[model samples]
Target chain A: MQNVTKSKWWQTMILKTIAMVLIGFIVFGPLMGTLLWSFAEKWFWPAAFPQELGLKYWKIAFTGQSPVLDSMAISITIALIVVVLATLISVPAGYALARFNLPWKRILLVLFLMPQAFPQLPVFINMTSIFYRYDLVGTVPGVIAVHLVISLVYSVWITTAAFKSIPVTLEEAARNLGASRLRVFFRITLPLATPGLIASSIFVFITSFDEFTGTFFIGAPFIQTLPTLMYTASMGYNMQYASVIAILLTIPALLFMLVLEKFLKAEYISGLGV
Target chain B: MQPRAAVKRPSIRVSDGQREAVSGLVLVLPALLVLCVLYIYPLCASIAGSFVSDEGIGLHNFAKAFTLYGTDILFTIGITIITLVLVFVVAVLTASFLRFRNWPFLNFVYRLPLFIPYLIAGHTMRVFLAPHGILNILISRVTGLSDLPGLAFSWIGLVITFVWKQFPLATLLILGAFQSVEDSYIEASLNLGGNKVRAVWEILLPICRPTVLVAMVLTFVSTIGCLTIPLLIGPSKPVMLPIDMAFRINYMGDWGVANALGVISYLIVIALSMYYLSYTVKKEDA
Candidate 1:
């Protein structure tokens, strides 16, 4: 028994060490590589580390030389607009789905979820073709419209959960007290769900901020976002420039990660893959 | 709990039901309208466009797509399957580790990718998997071998990128599931002299089967629609379906073939998603 336990313990030690090393490398290795490349003044073949490291690429990246700054501006602008629009559309829909007696409730919920559940590339491709008819293709508004598809997943689903979580009786009591229905909702439901609504908004912001597929399909070759800029730079073999912007984009994600654990419900994350 | 207002307006309550129904429709209308315009129309257009071909309204586009890009479809299937299996294994192990241990840093590290966009995942792999890149450098140093070729621009690299991208979410889901599994169940196996792996396989996994299924579904379908990882790390020749669709549309001006490929991709999603959709619906109803 002692021998068996001893050998088993040793085996576990070896296995755990291997697992740690592999996981650590898998998760962090690429990040380290990107960080090194961003500052690699003169990395060459056969050198495991950069021979020279400085912020040369970083300097060029922010200046008029690179498309980084403009892409950042456009990315933020579209995300903010999508956040506002998606929220307006979703809050009522979410509340109706959650607290009201709606017709075809299940089907409506399913329809709202179709964007997250389906293969979006096909939809985006067809959108590009359809948008051409209205001359919306390759425009900033076109990109924002495309972004609404994915951002709605966050806004609608999370808001539904938010409103669903608020006790229905609070709204009922306000209504019973002779408050108008609109007043009841605004005073009770909206304020009560505000924290979750804010979280939902942040989730929407991050998703729109990082949206790639639709932007690629609808806004590419004309309007450039950080994602498209990364694609072009990487394709053109400007690894350092791509790395710098990649790190820039990663900042919001990194910040949210600290707080994500609180909002990181399994249901919410199920909508992640765009 | 029974604090109803004694002087409640029964008349208002009766009319309130009717008003509620109207408001429900009005409130849900915007999202449904956006869904109609954004998703339903585009979807109908894609399906309709797929039927338009050189031979006129049939399987010509599909036939051409299969003849031209059959290998790419197979490649995509290969990548998805391989990534699914790897992601399942890794997720289970990571979730198991989290279940058995209390390492906060490791937990944080494992879940970080869940917060990231697929763009970063793709870009990170692009930089790391490039020829003469860090992965190669490390391999050469470890094994005393040099001149390793890049896996960055290949199907293997695509799989790696996806596993990295998809596993964190799977791990998050699986870990959440594992957290709810009664510790006494796992403890019973450990008390029987069973190892952690055995306990996981015999006790934990069976209990968490539904979550495992959900995680697998998420991992499987994710690779199908993905464009960035494939674009960044995939080989130029015989690319993934999204890449092929983009090329056909952007370069060849062949919306028929592109939309055909789109339909084919959607069919894959539909096949897998029927279960997922029903599952989600059931959960929603619950």
Candidate 2:
């Protein structure tokens, strides 16, 4: 009888190589198209690769000719504000939940985690009307509010996990040495949790930076971010401009997340886009 | 200071328990306040607004939504289901590869799209999947065949884009679970004369089933909620719910129908999650 259970070594090698090539294409193929287009000044069908490659579109983007620079600045500004605000709000709460016997603590955890369960687009749809009442629609404040809500999923959870990972005994030991509670926290706890805190802040910044549905609903037609700008550029089939913006929007996120993948918990990393 | 004086002074120094309680409350309130004001308030408003309409507070808006965009709702569900299945398949294969293999280039490439945002993902897919786009050109050149109808601006485009975009996150989650599972399990199966495929199928996958399910559910939920993918590459005749909901609001200025549709999507997520939660809880209890 022929052995059907095992493949030959060469067959396995071939299969593995094929799988890798397929995976590589599936992963990098679209991005390559975008990258090529970003440089392509004139490229038509029947030819593989760009007909002409130049920095013409890139110069337009970099020289503040298009709204790309403004949009990029605005996106960074909003992401920074949201990251700081989210960090400020999440730190104490995360520490409290991790260390204290707060009332309805379970409910609070569930509430913080609620964004994972809820579909966000609808809430944003309704938010437009609600924020409109307060003159927040199409304003930076309104957009920031939306980003803050989404940021909570990562900020609160990661912050809580960060604090929780530090042993309470360490804090208690410091406390027994005649150290004040605030002093113990500042010195003992915060230092230990810095890695997680930094990761959490980066996560918030990434979320707020890439945020589209919320920003689109609450801030479009007035506020323009890299994502919103990319959307318009793509809509017009301005492939060169869109591709340039796409590359801009992508690089920081990839770089930060590569660093982030080391410090953040697997669970928190998975929580992204949830 | 006498005890009576302390009581009369209303506690110049509060009790430890009381102090802790206040501290906990103070520390916890700001995050909760943000959640309440930004998330909870608008969510409630969406639900509440769906009810009040021209006629009265009822399912009138729901009935209207179903009548107008019922096909789009179904289309959304169909795309979600198709995307979930494809995403699940891609996630499992890629995650298993990452776990079982030590290919450095594979590792680096797999993670490239993981952090790319949705809108950017949409545009890239829009171009790459276009009729005479790069993918099509490559296929024709390789196979020596022409007349390849492309996937862009159709259901397949949406599926490919969703799977491609979601692949990294889903694989990361599944791969994380796979990593936690000890090598001994797979080694045990292999020692018993089981093949690598069998070892992975029987040992590794079963151990990581819960994470797989959660990953699937998350992908499903987000796929339904996705507006960017469909808007960028959706078919004109039957669209997804988000696009439909957007049209109702942007074009028609119909908030009632939008909220109704929103509630419907919300209910779908809640029902699935509740089932998952109950299943996990019941398993833990057992």
Candidate 3:
């Protein structure tokens, strides 16, 4: 009996360890591969590791000689613009939806969900023709407008939930205490909702940064972002350069995720549940 | 405090209600304008473009699209289904473990992939799964399995990349569901002489059905419309729908066929969206 129990304990331990190791490899193995390749000068077949390592690719990506630095700058600029615009647009709309018993509220909710739920290819294709006619193709603002279509949905949905989560009584109490409406909003509501707002902004920034197909359709030929640059380089057989850019693009997203980790529970419940 | 004063206050109350309504409309106007111009108009124009060609108002372009790229449509559906199944299995297992187990490192590992962009994830997989890539190198060294099957630019590679990129989201969502499930139900099942597997299958899964369904539908919709994974790691022959539509426009300048394909993809997503919307509505009502 004792031997059987001991063997059972060993079996469970071994199974748990196996699961942990496999999950670790599946999640981190490819990441490690990209990291090595970014610095590798001569990695080839039948070798367990790279034969040589250098920062040539990294240097090229950082220097202005390559398109990478410019593309990175373009991506950041576009994402920042998207963050500001999405926040500005979503806050009021989210507030109305959360606080008011408006007509067609359900229809409005569905309308907000449509951009995210529908296929983007059709929209991108259609926008290409309109953009061409309006002379908006190959322009930064054009690309930003298209990205807004997607990011706005996330911001509105998230901020709506954010507003909904704030207790209504707090605002009423402030009003009863003779606080002006604007003062009540600025002093009571906004501060309490800051975490959700920040989370939504981070989400908007990431979505805009990673947007590709729409950007490719609208911003090609004249404007280039990091994603489009990576696509072109990889297609053109420049994997080393692509790897460096990939790492550079990943840094901001990872940092946001780390910042978001503490707010994960709140964000998940109010921001992402819908 | 008298009747005349009450009458005056009622008139003011009516005006206040009207003002509130007007302000609410004003608040939502910008979002509404963007949706119309950027989303609704473009989608309508694309669908209309598909039906109206030189012949004027017909399914002729759709027929042309089908005859030209039927295999691509089928391939996209197949890939979506496969990725959906794999994601479901992986997410369920991982979510269960994370919810029930006490391993902090495992939790961190599961969240690692959530930060990665799809394009970067594709590149990472390409580097690792290439013909002479790190994975093959490691396998050859350890198991004497040289010249193992290459995965880059293959359907298998695309599936692996999609699963890796998407399953973390599924796990996060499903784990949210799992955390809400009561431990007492599983305990009751155990006390009733059921095994752990049976307890999970009978008690927990049934309760989490709606959430799991939502997660699966989301995975299906997103995977079907995906471009980067299929474009980066997928094969050149039987391409995915997004890639096919993109090439038709970018390479051939065939707007008619591209718009037709676009309509087809849109219809599929719309159908799925309707189902999801209904589910949410039903849940709300319940």
Candidate 4:
């Protein structure tokens, strides 16, 4: 019995080690390869590592000749616009959903969520006609408008969750103490909900930044974002340039994820259900 | 506690209620307007566009779309199903292990993919799975298989990329469900002569069914509609639905057929949405 138990312990330990190693490979293998490939000058097969490394691709990525720098700027500009517009629009709607007893409240909430329910392909394809009519196709604002359709859902849901989590009694108490509604909101409610609001904004920003299909459909030819640039490079077999672009695209998202780490658990659970 | 106060407050509350209603409408109006113009209008136009063609408003375009892109639609569905199964299995195992086991780094590793975008993930897959990629190098070195087939630009690569990008979300969702499971149930199962696997299967799985279902539906819908992974890694022939629809527009300039395909995709999403809605409503009622 002692020997059997000891063998079982060894078996479990080995299994766990293998599992951990496999998980590590799955998570980090591609990421590491991409990082190495970005800097590699001659990373041929049948060798364990890159034969030589240089900053040629990185230089190209940073130079004005390549679309990388411009794409990054465009992506950031569009994402910021999306974040600002989504926040401005969603905050009031979220506040209403949280504080008021509106008619067909559930339906309204579902309507906000409906944008995400369908595939973006259909919507963007359909919008291409209207955008063409309005002369908005291949324009940054047009892409931003399309992105708003998806980003608004998350922004509203998350911001509503943020508002819902705030205690009503605090607002009422402030009101009773002769504080104006605006003052109560700005002073009392806004400060408390700042973290969640920031988190939701980050979500909106990332969603917009990572938006590919809509941007590709609407912003092609005239507007080139990082994702669209990456797609073009990858399709054109410019692996080295694509790697650099991928890394650039990942940096902001990674930073935001770290910032979102604290608030994400609560926000995802509470906000996503509806 | 407030019968007298309630009666006394009604007169003051009447005007307050009206003011509140007005403010509520005002608050939601901007968002409603944006949704109406950006979202509702586009949706209506899409539906309308799908039904209209050269021959007038009919199902002709849809029939063409079905006959033309049927394989692509089926392929998309097949990939979604496969990805869903793989994601579900990986998510459940990883989530349960992280919950019950004392693997601290597992949680961090599982979540790392969440930070990576689909575009980057696809790039990573291509980098690692190419003919001269690191994966082939390792396989050749270890297994002595010199002529191993390249996995890049294939359905397998697409699956790998999709699973890598999406399974983190599934794990997180399932982990949330796992967090709500009572420890005592597992202990009780153990005390009743069940092993850990049996305990999970008997006690935990049933409790997590709803969350698991949600995760599956979410993964299915997202994967079926996804364009980046399949675009980057998927083969040219037997393309996914999104790519097929795109080709219809970009190459063929056939808006009618493309819109028809879009409507078909929308119907699939609507079906899933109905299921999700009913499930959430039932959960609420319960």
Best by DockQ: 4
**Highest lDDT: which candidate?**
2
Off by over 4 Å in 1: A1-21, A262-274, B1-19, B184-199, B273-286
Ordered by TM-score, highest first, the candidates read 3, 4, 2, 1
What TM-score, over all chains together, does every model reach? 0.89, 0.90, 0.92, 0.91
Worst 10 residues of 1 chain B by lDDT: B6-15
**CAPRI quality level assigned to candidate 4 from its DockQ score:** medium
User: Candidate 4 lDDT, tens digit per residue, A143-259?
Assistant: 999888888888888888888888777876676667777898899988888877888899899989988888888888889998998889988988888888888889888887777
Against the true chain A, what TM-score does chain A of candidate 4 give?
0.93
Evaluate residue A267 in candidate 2 and report its C-alpha lDDT on the 0 to 100 scale. 45
- For residue A100, model 4's alpha carbon misses the true position, in angstroms, by 0.9
> Of 1 and 3, which scores higher on DockQ?
3
lDDT scores in order? 0.83, 0.85, 0.83, 0.82
Stretches of model 3 off by over 4 angstroms after superposition: A1-14, A267-272, B1-19, B270-286
Question: Which one wins by DockQ: 1 or 2?
Answer: 1
Instruction: Write model 3 residue lDDT over B33-99, tens digit each, in one string.
Output: 9989999999898888888766778998999889988988888878887898899999998888777
- What is the descending DockQ order? 4, 3, 1, 2
Q: For residues B1-286, what per-residue lDDT tens digits would candidate 2 score against the true structure?
A: 2345433433222356667778898998898898998889989999998998889999999999989988988888888888987888888887887788777887777877778898989999988999888899899999988878989999988888998888787887888888878989888988999987787787877777678777878798888998998888778779888888889899999899899999999887777667766876676566
TM-score of chain A of each: 0.88, 0.91, 0.93, 0.93
**Superposed Cα RMSD, model 4:** 3.4
DockQ of 2: 0.48
lDDT of 4 by residue, B255-280 (tens): 88888888888787667657766875
Q: What TM value does chain B of candidate 3 have?
A: 0.86
